[model samples]
Target: MTKTFKTLDDFLGTHFIYTYDNGWEYEWYAKNDHTVDYRIHGGMVAGRWVKDQEANIVMLTEGIYKVAWTEPTGTDVALDFLPNENKVNGTIFFPKWVQDHPEITVTFQNDHIDLMEASREKYATYPKLVVPEFAHITYTGDAGQNNEDVIAEAPYKGLPDDIRNGQYFDQNYHRINK
Candidate 1:
């Protein structure tokens, strides 16, 4: 038998870590730990599931998703997942005052996600900034996995100083507990 997720309920109680590959490297904690009445808009469903105080809206389409929020910070993100593959191509557009947005690609499987920036020229001026041109992160505490055990056995260590000191490479973010 094959498994299919046709509704938000399928993802409820799931937790995952989201990482960005831009020079100002950052990671987001995502948890589908809430239940809400999702508003259906045409071919998309919009609602909030992540445990954040900001007003957020998530739109889901076939193989694509868009999540936008306003509060502590404002951001507009769109992700297009590849067919049958744990890979996605996306872009992040920040409001003015943040920085120029860049195209990003991501791949995920089980409890891990890897992100890479597709455009480097966008930050030509801030050359010394260490952005995770590539970032790898893990999502623990899912599917009966122990968060502590996962963190202890995680492959990547702390961010290298070279990466912060101007050297650029794929960076790794340790698994964070929810």
Candidate 2:
């Protein structure tokens, strides 16, 4: 059977990177509506891992997409992509005992640097395409520490002002200790 979802349609074939106010940077690739390939640049729970999860994408409105997924560690992540508005709204539900402390969660806004963007209209429409296999990520034993120079040259200097100045619906979000 063929299935076409507006949410998924809006996200396919896009790549971008964003950094949280708290210094967390992530790169995301829209492999399909059902999943996203993501890599954590660094932060509280830094890692040199690329992970893809079965994600749910929904178009909340024109040019606004909501993507959510649960990680293997049982942490839940929900994010709103407002590319037209140049910002993202998200919350991370940290699994207990995994973060090395008693802290639990955080919600934040950040600006995105769009690496590539494409529309479903540009490609032939498909009801449902055969999804790809699980991803494989390779890493060298000493790459993490040895890559400090490259990390310092990361594209982000700080959270962009547009994101810092954007209005948010979730005003109840507060910064918590990690």
Q: What is the C-alpha lDDT of each candidate?
A: 0.27, 0.44
Off by over 4 Å in 1: 1-4, 18-65, 79-84, 100-178
lDDT of 1: 0.27
Worst 10 residues of 1 by lDDT: 38-47
Cα lDDT tens digits, model 1, 1-178, are 1223343433332222323343222223223332111111111111112223232324374433333343222334543322223333445444332244321211121122121121332333242222112223222113221212211221222422222332322222323332
Model 2, span 1-178: residue lDDT tens: 0122244454464544566665566655555657665556546554423334578977887677888886544456788776544466777765433354311211111111121012222332233221111111111011111122112212233322222343211232221111
Best by lDDT: 2
Residue pairs in collision within model 1:
23-131
Model 2: what TM-score?
A: 0.51
Q: For this target, which candidate reaches the highest TM-score against the unseen true structure?
A: 2
Give TM-scores for every candidate, taking all chains together and pairing residue i with residue i. 0.34, 0.51
